[model samples]
Target: MTRTSSAPLRSPVAALLAVLLAASGVLLGAGGAQAAGYRYWSFWEGDGKSWAYATQGPSLVRPDDGTVQGFRFAVSEDSADADRPRHAPDFGAICADTPAKGGAKRVALVIDPGTTEDAPAGEKPPALRTACAQVAPDASSAEALASVAKPLRYDSSAMICAISGYPKSGCGEQVSGDGSKKDGSGKPTDDASASASASSAPAADDGDSGGGPSAGLLLGIGAVLLLGVAAVFQARRRR
Candidate 1:
C-alpha cells in the first residue's frame, strides 16, 4: 500500500498562516504611522501668478511692495496638504484701488477661513476676502495680516488660534483626518460654542508642522492584505 504524505498540504497551510500574521503586523504599523492631524491656519506667500507654501513663518518673512500674502484655515496633516486661499494672488487687482505710498509698502492680503466642513463645530466660516494693507516698508507678513484682519487670537506658544474671532477657542488642536470631532457614539460633537472674546496677546510664528502617512500608503497596505487573504483561500482549496 502506498501512503500519500500530508506534508505538502501542511507546508502550504503554515505558509499561509505566516502570511496572514505578517499582514496583520503591516496593518497595525500603518495605522500607527497614519495617526492624527492638526486643524490650524497655514500661511502662504504668492507672486502675481500663484501661491507658494511659505518656508518661513509669517512673522519672519518681510513682504515687499506688490507682494501678496495668503492665510488659509483648515485641517491639514502638513503644509503639503494645506488648503490655499481661494482667490488668486493678483496684486494688481487687489491693490488697484489703493495708490502707492512713498514711505509705506502695498501688500495684498487674501484671507480664506475655509469651508464649512473645516470649520469648528457650531461655527461658520467667514467669507473669503481680499484686502490691500499699507504698512511700513519693513513690515513682516504677520504685521501685514494684522493690519487687515485684527483681533487675532493667540495661544500660550504664540500660535495664531483664531483670526477675527472665528472659532472662539482652540489652537492647532489635533483632530481626525477628516477634521471631525467624534464622540463615543461615532457621531460628530458640537462643542465649539464658546465665548467669542479675542486674546490681546501677540501672535507667534507657526513653523513647518509634521504629518502622518498618506492615504495611498494605507491603500497599498490594504491591497497587500487582500492578496494575502486570496493566497490563503487558494492554499485551503489545494488542501
Candidate 2:
C-alpha cells in the first residue's frame, strides 16, 4: 500500500490579505484610457485561458513602461514553469481613480512612446523610444482576459493610410524594425523636459546676482520655511 500526500494550502484569508496589500500599493483609476481606439489581439490555450498585446494612441494619462505597449507577457498557473504563480497579463496601464468602461478593469501603465512611424500625429517624432501612450477600449468586445495587437489595426500603414493615405501604402514592415530603439535626448521625453528646466540653474544663478545678497536672503528664508514644514512632518512620523 502507498500513502497519499496533499500539497500545502495558502489560507484564503492570507491570499485575500496579500491581494489587498498589493492593491493598496497600486495607484487607482485613470478612467477608460487604454482601450478606446486600440485593438487587442490575443492567443490562448485551454481552461478559457488567454494572453494579449494591444496598441493605441498616446495615453492621455497612464503610460507604457517599456518596449511593448504598457503590458507584459503573462503565464497562468497551468502554464507557468516550476515555482511561478499564475498572474493575469498586465499590459493595460490604469490610473488609481479611473472607472471601467463596460466593466473592464482599470490600471496605471507606463506609456510606450513608439518610433517615428508611431508618434502622435501632430507632434514632432520623439527622439527616444519612450514617452507616453494612454489607452482605453473603443468597444465592449475587449472583455477577454488576454490579447495582443493584430498590428494591421493600429499600424501607420494601415489605419492611418486607410483614413489619410499618410503612410503612402498598406501595412508592411520597416527596414531593420525592432522596438528596442533610442533616438531622443538619451532620456525619456518627459525627463528631458524636466532636465531642460534643471539645466537652466546657471542662468537663474547669474540672473539673481544682480539682485544681490538681499534677494538671496529672501529666497533662503522661503526655502527654510518649506524645510521646516517638511521636518515637522518627518518628526511627527518618527514619533
Candidate 3:
C-alpha cells in the first residue's frame, strides 16, 4: 500500500490567530476614536507690538431645541484677505477647548486663511505652537482700558474669546450672566451648562464691565463639515 501524506490539524492555530487579530482591530479602532475628537491645533504671530491667534472649540452639541453653541476661530491684527472683496484676515492658529464634563472629551479645531501645522492623531503640542501664546491674561480684561476710555492697547494687544448663549439655565452666577437668562429660579448653580466654563473667560470682562468684550474682534470656531467628520472619527477610535 502506498503511504499518503496527511495535513496537520490547524484548528488551534487558526483560533489563536483570529483572537489576536480581533484584539488588534479593537485597539486600532479605540485609538482612532480618541484621535478624531479634539481641538488639535494652535497658532499665533507677533509683529513686535501686535499679534493674533486662532483655535477650535469642542464638538458641537445638538440639544433638544436645536440651538448650536461652540466656537473655533482665528484672531488677527489686520483685516487679512481684505483685498479679496468681502473676506477676513489671515489667522495664526485655531485654539479649541472643551469642558471637563457634559460633552465629548475631544474637539477637533480647524481654521482657514493659512495652515503651518497639521498634526497627526495623539500629537503632543510642539514647542513652536506652545510658545505662540503669551499669558497676558491681564490684557484679556477691561482693566487695560482703565486709563483710556477707549482702550488703545486693546486694539493691538488684547484678546476677546468669550461665548455664551440664550435661553440658558443658570449660565452665569459666577462669571458673566446675572442669572437672568436662566429658565427658573430654584435651579441650583451646579446645574449650569457644562460648556459654560469658558463663559467666564469673556463674560467676566465684557459682561461685568457692561461694555462687552474689548477685543471686539475676538476669534470664533464654527461647526463645519470638515470638523464634524473628523470629530466623529476621533470618537469612534477612542472607543
Judging by lDDT against the true structure, name the best candidate.
1
The per-model lDDT (C-alpha) reads 0.69, 0.25, 0.23
lDDT of 1 by residue, 1-239 (tens): 88667688778767876877787677656666444455677777888788877666666678789999888888765455667889999999999999997999999999899999888888899899999999999998878888889888765444567778867876666676556653332211122101101111112214322243446656776777787778768866665
Compare candidates 2 and 3 on TM-score and give the better one. 3
What is the number of backbone collisions in each predicted candidate, taken in the order shown? 0, 49, 28
Candidate 2: worst-modelled 10 consecutive residues by lDDT: 76-85
lDDT tens digits by residue: candidate 3, 54-118: 12112222112111122222111112201111112212321123222332221111122112222
**Model 3 poorest ten-residue lDDT run:** 76-85
Each candidate structure's TM-score, on Cα atoms with residue i matched to residue i, is 0.70, 0.19, 0.24
Clashes of 1: 0
Model 3 TM-score relative to the real fold: 0.24
By summed lDDT, which 10 consecutive residues of candidate 1 come out lowest? 193-202
Clashing pairs in 1: none
Candidate maximizing TM-score: 1
161: Cα error in model 3, Å: 5.0
